[model samples]
Target: MRTCPHPFASLVLLITLSAAAQPPTSPLGPVSPTTGLVLRDDAVRALIQESSGDRIHDGVQRLALIARDTQSGYTEAAAWTKTAAEAAGLQDVRLEPMKDGPQWRATRGELWVAGAHRYRVTSYADLPMSLAAGSGAFEGADVELVDVGTGTQEAEYAGKDLKGKVALTRGPPVAALRNAVVKRGAVGVVSSYSTPPWNLSHRMDGDFPDQVGWGLVPRSLSTPGVPAPFLFMISDRQGRELLAQLRAGPVKVDVSIATQTDTGHLSIVSGVIPGTRAGEELVLTAHLDHYKPGADDNASGSATLLELVRTYTTLIRRGVLPPPVRTLRVLWLPEFEGTREWFSLHGEEPVRRVAQFNFDMLGASLTRAHSRFQVSYTPDWNGSFVNAVSESTLAFMNRFNSVVYPPRKDFRIGSVTGSQDPMDAHMERYGRGSDHQLFNDHGIPGVAFSTWPDDGYHTSGDRPENVDPTQLHRAAFAGLASITVAAWAEGAGALELARLVALHGVRRVAEDEFRARRDLTSVPVAELPETYRLTRAAVRIAYQREREALRSCLSLGAPAAPVQAMAKALESAEAQALGRLEVDGKARGASLREASPSAAERQARTFVPRRVKGQELASFDELARKAAPEQQPRVAAVQAAITAAETALRERGEGELRFYQLPDALASYADGKRSVADIRDAAYAEYGHVFPVDALVELFGLLEQGGVMTRIR
Candidate 1:
């Protein structure tokens, strides 16, 4: 038998080791060079000291009390947040409403096994997530609940009599409802489906077995003559139990949903910390809508924004920090839809939206959730000085919260009444699935601060208890510091930040060269020529990419002379790196040569796609729903291509580009100047995925047909 050590043994060992550990005794000099950030360290520190985890937690707990959607609940939450912002002394605090048309709201809902045993399956009163969004009303007592396993196919219901009954399925609510409710005449659906574990590491049924999923039924009910019915989400464990009970005999359950589908406007809650400059500002945003108890998925992010407002406002008012040179504005809105609506209405406002720092999920307990705080910077193709600044700020927080043996920094930070868990944070290339997508899609660079692989994401497990107050404090500190640094990027600090952009630009370009060279040198001789072609293309495109990134520094009010110089240096760097590649190819008996464009590539090169004056690519879901009847087939084909591209890229271990990011990446490069071929090459270089030229041609063709873009011969 194995013996257990005392629980205090590790603590005692750590103390003993600390006493005997050899070191320079005193703190060492900086292990790394100082980050060229124009941070107001004193002000940032004051804000950090003033930030309240408890207050943030209170905000989250309060917001999570309402099952917020794009309906009345969202309006209520917005009103509360608006009041809080005003009370915190933030100027220009108000709720701006944007109509999203009619939306669904569930008032009372419950599903229970109504036999002798009286087993309660779920109730919206107890857990709001149990009621899926867009679910219609269905009141019935002891309706026969038939187990139709994955009832998404006709074959699953061939022999089942679901007429006037309820379907218990392990498939998506929409798909199951279409088959069981629409085709087989079922009255409602009980779905216990979770996305496959491989795609989302933590959203597996095995991980959170009792988590009632949050999902949506189709809003339009676009199918002709199909009745809109109710949808109830039960846990995977409850679903399994129901399935097991079905093995013995049939089950009868009572289903009641008092829901309403009504017109409501999506609203945005806005507050600002005043600045010296009138027309320039940095935007911080978080989505405020999710199911009840949606703590980490975004109540945490929204609550943190409130805390930032309080801390920054109080600090500035107390003379702890000077007013910003550029205004700092924060927004709480419905995810995606609200952002798109806001920008559409205010796209040409005189106020320049310089940059964005979007907080999405910031309060996951790192240890419990097996999650790490991630700063997803701007994409490589869309790289900016903001990334370097964010990196520097994250580094500062890491050192500030660490338990270094001999301390690199002279100070450390931890909440006295909160967790002491080490801050696990890292930086990665751009990722989609947040409000920042809107900023990056429209030529503005943005960064999204979040936690990933959250097991409870989009489920009932995303409760307030799962959120850590300490994590909120750290995230708030890092985000506030980063945005402040960017806001104050002028004078000497701006020069340093500009230099940092140049340095990071060089490294980014060099990284592409490094990867290409490694692959070129190792490939067989017959494949060497083709590899060299792609290698050379990567190096050339990297220079252009980094050059574009360097230009973003000018948005910080940095001097144009230095930024232009840095851009010129990128060309020089590319030449040097390409020259080295030539030497390697020469030694390998492969001559450096550009591959002639194939017929398809040449054809693609002839057509230039331009945005339709001022239109961003509509989301695929919206396009599918709104497309004319004749365009339905085309929409389906385009979606298939997107799925195929993402699948192929994933199979090749490519993660930089995700499925949802394809349209945005394409839109980013389609500036009316770059041909389809040029855009494809640049996108390939940025993401390391070789999307076929034909795919680009077809996508652009579809976009043109949709009136979002136009093709010039």
Candidate 2:
């Protein structure tokens, strides 16, 4: 490693330059570039240098060889993690059992186009994802291949003879199974569906034509007497070739699959380093389970987690860093189900959880994936100092990892064995669909680091070769640094955190107010009143969350003076922003007077909905099955609304809430204290979308009707 004789001066100057770019009162997040929190300069630099991309890359390569898909592969991966954690000097490393999850493992599978000549498309031996999980056993069954585009709707299957034939569709495999196999007696399905393209710039098939996607047919979708349908996922190019052959002549396809299903427990691997504080903890989490060869989708994250354990433990043992004040725990688990189970265990220990950092899909090569590394800050409703810490770390990584013009000798933060690729990293607003959601839903704030426009996510192209070592090194450095700063927070460090929270709060308020102004300016006069109400709710709700974030500093043993001073400054900033919003509204011919809630909103205020323990809605399919007969139509309607909203948002390529995420957002606020009106308001503030009160009221009513929830009078 090269020596930077005076790097601290360069580090400080970088922060000063970044702050100067913004207003003095609202600097981005933290004072120092590294770790965001106030900590020893020497320790921060050492942590950065200690992160090894080669070590992380080796771990990723090893883990990618395991078919870790929440079953046999997941169990095997858990054992490996347990042993590795112990070797890294972590205490109390164990594999915890999460019970009652569906389990299935592939034995042998292959798909071939058969006739006078045989052409093998794929096999489980070559790509495990080619054989969808939960597929039934079949032996060399030859069936006619029918081309039913999408294969999800009756229209797609119209006038097609699918009986005992294998259906080929570019839609979800599960949906194809339900509509074509279960309902219409198809033998199986060959799907080529990948995640929808992000935009015109990032088309999955155009970029990675040979990528075979991962798919599954859930056991719940099985018919009573009918055999379970097997599904095979082929690449888009292969699928298109099959379609062309079908147009020319009748096509015969041979499919074989052998799988076993058992009711077994999912696994969670947890490793901890004890601290002076007993129950208070900071957790670093990454899902260790995905398909085989899933390097960037999750193996990268899990590998980086292992590296953090090794680096931190080694540093503390070598007397290079101080022992943490709070307990630090690292978790590798199956994505959603395992996360929920982990939180359910320990009798809901959310109050003791100070913060969490989540890593997922962190090793993409910028040039290969055309993706950017994103730090998704905590949701607005559960605001905390963690967001500030994350923002600061992100800024540091962006500046240090990228090539600066007239590169200075004083600034050196590069891995020796890793590529010195300029990083495309920045902060993103709250995003869903990762292990971090469970923590946020439990009222504990967390942040997720990920790469977006992942070209091969859930596809065969997410192989070890697709991962970049430099990206892994940068992510590990930033992630470990963020957690370390929080773990060691005390008097002076806590004070700095307090100031950072206030500084970040002012910037957020400004951003929110600016968005609201744009919305108000565009609204038609007829809809101005309703739009103005939403705008007011958005800005005020944001200010309240900022206050809550400031208050969170007291838990870090921060002195009352800094906390109070920052709170006052936060108040002043919000007040100024609100005044500007008022002027904008008045100029647009909207009244600034406080307006009462509409009848629907007022009625919503009366019902305080609480989720039934252990019965919260987990998926839309589960809700459809569990809802009462009369409520089925309503549940379907609500789900349809969510889908429509999600499509609209995605088509426009903006907003934070995905259709699938709306339920969790609503559930996060349903703590028996917030009225339906309050939940609606919070949702509006968080995503800038006004969910209809009728839709929310109907959804909860159906849940209550199904014994999944109870509404207080």
Candidate 3:
């Protein structure tokens, strides 16, 4: 969790992993050092204070305070935030003003909208909608209105004339609607949707397209904004029903949306506490807009960021904070729009780089009231930042929950990199959801934090009581810690920083590389070819073939019985080797000597990555000759298996398994007799197995239970 920046969960695979420091004394730490400095920065503290805001805890006091403050357009909350920062002795703190666009906003009681309508209306209830918008061609004008739904399928309007009439469509990809109306020569367009305020819909940046010359009419009908005949949008259930009825009666709506129609106001916030190295930038951020108060919605995140700035400023003032390797830029935005402005203006990738840690919710506990602390992350081939960050976050969580806060594993941290590798796909899931949206959109390795299924995410229920100070403190700390790690790695040596990540953050769930490869295959063959840096000797390189082959055998839930048998054997062999092995002599293998693999086979199957003699296969003809070597009657089952084995080898080749150059696909661990599991253990980590085709498939569904590969999908 990043305080100046960045949520919670529950059965985690608690590996009993150790952290550098002993657990803290309380979950409510005034601070915890993530990278170098303390975690719970002032911004987080202020937010916690703000959550328990300076007013009576009564409903009227809160609403009255909100109502008294006018935050429309330039007269926004951001404007006041500047005054507050300055009052606190902060310098260079300014609100990043947002663009208001070409649309106009009407004042109270003014006739902001007035338009000619073939369908007349007195109130919202009388306005016609379905026939006026949903219908492709109504009342047969010279040109027909092309009714587009969502506009995702452009092929829907192959040969239609949409000249002069309205192009009524559905939802906002505002740019798309603008293009359609301008291209098709419609007078205007009306898009529709019936979603809630926080639905996200994966389509919000509503920036209208250029190269089009048409006015726009958005029939948004969602929870946030209303249709103004303004270029923007609107929604209402009862009114929509009445409008639908009137339209069914053949009424047409040509309502004016803009008399002076436009958004009320919008702006993004960016604050920087200059690091020693300003040329390199580390952007920490969160969004600050919701239909309501949005405490956990985002006020929590933005407020936390402010606290970080405050903490750093205090540290700098006291000269206690170390000069950073990179400049720290904390940004607060109105979701996508803030990021859009930054990218639209300054899209260049930061030359002096660390990583981006965006914290969205990050401060709520007990949606179920029994869930553990959670950490979500993103990974990259460039050593995957997400893996390390989550590891770090969980380390903090465990310390807080287990040691500091007392005996409870209630707080747990994890990164999204586990089941869904956003680094491979769906960075948008995290990136687009918050201020990081633009960062990822710009191709930076970034990760954002927010609570999952937050009960009061966007609704009125999203008040300050929902926030957890303990969680907020952890988030602030985690964000700073990961950023520092990334910066330290960039400024110093990458491997050193990476080692800290490996140690404090991310788990090498399965080491021997071979076993880990299985986790990859369970995902998809297409994914296996994707590169992940590995070390033959402490250096990283992407060798997809060997990785993929290992992945395939491990991926199969359970390969054929022969393969499972082989894997079990390999497991046995490694147990034996590891028993005699001692780096610091930690792993206890002496007690299970009988459980070890065969001595000869175990020695042969050492971690050499090349097949040794004795277990080696000759040419197919030679193998056939040996299979029938002077036997009175070769068993039919044995003969059939031999043929299958040859075919299996051929199939593996198609999948890029160069088995002939290596050893036979591990069939069993050396159970004093060498099996496949033993071979894998010998090859990699503890308690391992690698099933080629048969046994691998069976294991896929089973391994998930043990947090091996939770689910292939």
Candidate 4:
């Protein structure tokens, strides 16, 4: 018997059996006939019916009134959230302080052309986004405006003298500021960046003539040698006018910026609704920081979470819903940085957390924003039954709302004025953009509920009016229902979850096999064996994920009998799947031995590889300095590739590219127990063919050269 970490695990089987014998008569609802699980229809109805769209809209409007990144704004919002939670009868409501570096505030900003064309460009008093975040204080000074296309590459400034001038670029303000101000000695920077619409399915206008976003100049670039400069963001329309003026004649601008940075703490608001079990928790989180009028980006998410908290607490207080078996904790904080600080302060508190449900941009109007409500799963490597649970809940809500409130000509809900149409919710693959990444990085299963393709994202135009209350309600309903089921699940619920994992695993394995077969045409004949190995390994990984999902039920204190039965069933299922594959391989004149590597082929497995934390290859020169004298040429080639990857990532506004083009299966084999030859064989076993041996060598070599990993001798 496996020792359970949870103290309540011992009582789970007893409570589950007792509950099953005597069904509660009150608000606990009925027991599922098929799976013997408890179904709280009353709780589900309260979550759906009690959720107020109007209340959510009001919350968004109130929060959108101030830029929440500022100290005063953050404190006010935190206080308001705490008061709201307390008013809803939630327990342990508090304002937790996070140790963020500093608070940045923009007070004043102005830019005006003085030579040949006397006209004002933009002002912070008129638009906060025009000032850009992290800009330092500067007085009015007339400087020539130099148009450097993109302003990121050194070639952009080949013959241009940027000293004492303001460089204008089409890239983002942060990138342009780094290149022109810190690197080229420019006094300031101006950026005109826009995200173009790729779809006309919803038929919304794509032109954003006045949209501007936040920017940052790292403190590292603000040293005495390289002074950080005041950066300004303008719309594409304003950029075109300035560029045209520059082309006609010499144009100089008078610029003045007043911004301040001081030591400050980030405010994180948290509240809990206690459950029957102790220590077990499910966290619901949303970011509370953004520019003023950041409605769809995050205010919508915060409002939705608040509404859920209100609805849940109200139902529990009224005795219409029973308390869950696991605690429900809600958190409102700054984005990634704030989450990191919270984790640092809490230490191992996260170990008690079973799952995280993150809300971000969940209230966009589908027709206006060209958005789709998505429940994005955690990546395959972190697969769990939570994915199926969330997906099923969203699908159920989508169907329920369509029948109850069909889309009218005005797109209003039934008898509700100004409300939008029903939600067009769908499942999406894994994506990394919000605070959920922080939770997932700490081994917590985190999922995101968001709306994508919002035109007002990170822009001055994102206001409360653009948010759809009906969409917010639907998202809240889905999130509430999914998490409630997980929090209150018992023996029967665990069995149901196990079944879903098995089905999902089978489907995933079939999809992997299909993809591998399709990729065979692209593989070289010599590498076919490696490809076959990789494909098999993928199937094995799918089975293992299913097993892990089933085992996780043990954490919920499920009965040993049912849990063991499910494990045995899974073993048989995996055997049947593998047996079919083996039979197919035999008919094709191939054998299992051809796919699996011999013992002699395996390298020594005693050496362990450890990854170096917080180390990055910042530049080609840094890579050369780290590499040995004889390895400079190879390091230089890899450095060039990394540089190009970084450039591409910047242009696309995406994350870093540490393992670009490397298969997850291959990467997973890099654990200390596996040697380089073992990893190669594993890759072939899973992917249906091996990658070039030289390619694997180069990858490990680059990792060593870049200070990311070191081999234990």
Rank ordering of all candidates by TM-score, starting from the highest: 2, 1, 4, 3
Q: Show model 1 residue runs off by greater than 4 Å.
A: 1-37, 40-44, 196-199, 222-227, 404-411, 522-530, 591-596, 620-641, 652-657
Worst 10 residues of 1 by lDDT: 23-32
Model 3 residue 396 CA deviation (Å) reads: 2.1
Candidate 1, residues 355-410, lDDT tens digits: the string is 89999999888878778888987865676778877777777777667653315332
Which digits, one per residue and each the tens of the lDDT, describe model 3 over residues 1-713? Answer: 65631112111222223321333111112223542212333322332232221111222112212311123522445665556455544556766666655433222111111223333222212221211211121122322334555555667556756555544454443543555654555544544443233333211222212111112234442123422222323332323433464365532344333133335446666666665544676777776554334556566666666655665555445444344545777666666656667666555554543457777776655432122234434322222444444454445544534433243233222221111111111111111335543453343556776554454443334556666555565555555455644443331233233333334221242233443344333433332322111112111111221122122222212233433343344445444433333211222222211234355334334322222222222222223334433431333333444345445534543211112212112211122332333333332221121223223222221222222222212
TM-score of each: 0.90, 0.90, 0.45, 0.81
Candidate 4 residue-wise lDDT, 58-104, digit = tens: 88999998777678777888788788778877789988877656678
Tens digit per residue, CA lDDT, model 2, 600-634: 77778898988777754354456667766877778
**Candidate 4: worst-modelled 10 consecutive residues by lDDT:** 197-206
Per-model CA lDDT versus the true structure: 0.76, 0.78, 0.39, 0.68
For model 2, the stretches where C-alpha displacement exceeds 4 angstroms are 1-30, 33-37, 100-102, 196-207, 349-351, 404-412, 590-597, 613-621, 655-659
Alpha-carbon shift of residue 207 in model 1 (angstroms): 2.3
Instruction: List the candidate 3 regions with Cα displacement exceeding 4 Å.
Output: 1-71, 87-90, 95-100, 103-259, 262-267, 349-351, 368-375, 382-387, 402-432, 458-461, 484-496, 504-713
Candidate 1: residue 492 Cα off by (Å): 3.1
Q: Top lDDT: which candidate number?
A: 2
- In terms of TM-score, the best-performing candidate is 2
Indicate whether candidate 1 or candidate 3 has the larger lDDT: 1
Better of 2 and 4 by lDDT: 2
